[model samples]
Target: MRECLELAPDAIEVDQASVVQRLGSSRTNCENGLFQESFTAAQGFLAATARPRCVVQTVDLATFAGLYDGEGSNDRDTPLEVILERSEALALFVLTLGQTITDTIRRLFSEHDYLVAALLDGMASLVAESLVESLETRFGRHIAECDGKSTTPAVLAYSPGYCGWHVSGQRALFSVLKPNEIGVSLGAGCMMRPLKSVSGVLVAGEPEIHDFDPGYSCCSGCDTLECRARIARVTGPVCAKREVAWICSDG
Candidate 1:
């Protein structure tokens, strides 16, 4: 089944500390006037312009693998590939904080207001991610409910530009997800317009399935090994295991 979720702006809880950290500054160090001003401006922009929307469609492993293989330059052997192989279910999702935020960021940049622009951009990214996290949680709950299982599946999202997935992979993803329904468009190099948008596959299965050593060829060049943190989120007690029988339709 396919689901289109329209999220209220207030539903996205943006962590100010995380936004500050993304800006390469900590909350303690952000007491300076410039940082304070930029952050306040970013909050105002978010409140006034943010509109979060997400679309998700579930697909069987075979179909998901085809999309993965279609991305020509992608590393076939990687943790993401292994995780997908082990997944009981998969869903492709795309989300955006709407075009207004993107336009605001660009306008700020054009006006040489780089500080506020940076802060807003960072907050938008965090907001987009929070939407993804919410979707993951919802999908996990849906899986448990459908299966009448007591244990909720562990869900983790993997994007085209991350791990070993080639950025060009977004082309195949967009072809399926069709994020344009939510005013997001694919541009040159498979980059999504509304620059604050995010697209990826949510993998659901046993928590242990997501645990893997980051020793693949793709790991060498990675500066921020975010996979470790992502994996940690899902590692825990064993749960009932079953292959999801649901097949996602092309929406």
Candidate 2:
């Protein structure tokens, strides 16, 4: 069954430090007057505008493998495929910060309020990520519950348009996940409509499954290489294994 999540704005937790970092400026060096004003305005706008929503549907490994390969153009040998093949469970999900935020961003840009617009744009990206992080944690707990075990599986999300998963792969994914039910639509080039939204599959398995060398052919063109930091969070010595719980609500 597909699960729906309606998250409160405060639950998204967009901290100023993270916003500053997302904006390409560190708090320590961010003393510019305009930057400060924009940052403050972005925070306020996000607080008033963010409407975090998510939909997730879990599928057996075989089903996901078909979806992953259905596109026919994806490089099956990529690190993302390797990690997912090792997963004990998988779920497809779409998360959006709602249309109002994107509309406001367009308005800001039209009015030449570039500074605040950029800051809000970056902050919205962070909030979308934060929503994914929360889902991963909750889904990890749900896995433990379903197995009737005390395991703390590491659940991480991987999307198309990166790591050799062709952007067109979204077609196969959207066919099954049907994000349009929650107002997220795939447009030309497979970009989600809200612009601040994210869609992907969450893989649950031992933390070690996520570890991969960054020397893969796909990694050559990638600039972010964000998987390293995410893997480190799960595999690090201080990584905590919390109990799993169901991610969807009856309400």
Q: What is the C-alpha RMSD of each candidate to the true structure, in Å?
A: 4.8, 2.5
Name the runs in model 1 displaced over 4 angstroms. 236-251
lDDT of 2 by residue, 1-251 (tens): 57887776665556778777877776876677877888888888888888878889999888888888866888746887788768898999998989999999999999999989988998899878867887788888888998998876989899988788888888999999988777899888889998888988989999999998987778887899898888987999887443222245436
CA lDDT, every model vs. true structure:
0.82, 0.83
Query: Alpha-carbon error at 190 in model 1, in Å?
Result: 0.8
- Report the lDDT tens digits of candidate 1 across residue range 25-141: 867888888788878988889878898877899989888888987658998577887787778889999888898888998999999999898888998887777667777777898
Total clashing pairs for each candidate: 1, 3
* C-alpha lDDT of residue 67 in model 1: 93
Displacement of the residue 35 alpha carbon in candidate 1, Å: 3.0
Instruction: Candidate 2: list runs displaced more than 4 Å.
Output: 240-251
Q: Tell me the TM-score of each prediction against the true structure.
A: 0.90, 0.92
